[model samples]
Target: MTSPEVDFTRRNPTARPLTDKERDALDEFVDSIHYSSRYNDDHYEYRHVQLPKQMLKKIPKEYFEPSRGTLKLLWEEEWRGLGITQSLGWEHYEVHEPEPHILLFKRPMNYQPPAQH
Candidate 1:
């Protein structure tokens, strides 16, 4: 299945830097989102990890998926929003949980942001 696209520019144009507390809140929110989404679904296991502030900055607030209870990291959001798919010669990105406190997101090898015109 394919993920949905989100217009980051329109969603969070000039998103301000989050404070330390907000960063923590984002982490907690991600956990809650994952848990709520997977609690009743046997196919998914709830898991979460702290991401660096730099990495998190690229993510749009709307990507948190509060309404649908899903987690959308920066790379996934970018991939979807840019309309680059595996069938379109775009490499797939992977979400990595290296440890309990670190979540790594690997961007597609050849992704280029859509030119703003």
Candidate 2:
């Protein structure tokens, strides 16, 4: 939630798949909600089908949309990607993108650092 990332620890692989526990977390966000879960041999991803009031709520008080890109910025700072060297590839990050709304939680699992900055 903090990072917008689906944490990809080995046991969970595609990172933390939403379980009953995560679903429970969404209660705070749910006025109504729906989703679809998908999986490959290795990873899993669940797309948000519907957003209830709780999830639509603003950061502190009222209801609004959740900006995943904004969340990802906070998350990268928290994760310290800023401290890592920048590469043309996945090992480095944009730190911030031109479109904050577009960059969600994405950790390139197959990232290979490019030769130049």
Lowest lDDT block of 10, candidate 1: 32-41
Q: Number of clashing pairs, model 2?
A: 9
For candidate 2, what is the lDDT? 0.29
lDDT of 1 by residue, 1-117 (tens): 233233343222332444556555455334222211111122222222344434444444564435433333334334334222222323222234333123322223344667769
- The lDDT leader among the candidates is 1
TM-score of each: 0.24, 0.23
Report lDDT per candidate: 0.35, 0.29
Off by over 4 Å in 2: 1-31, 45-50, 53-55, 61-69, 73-117
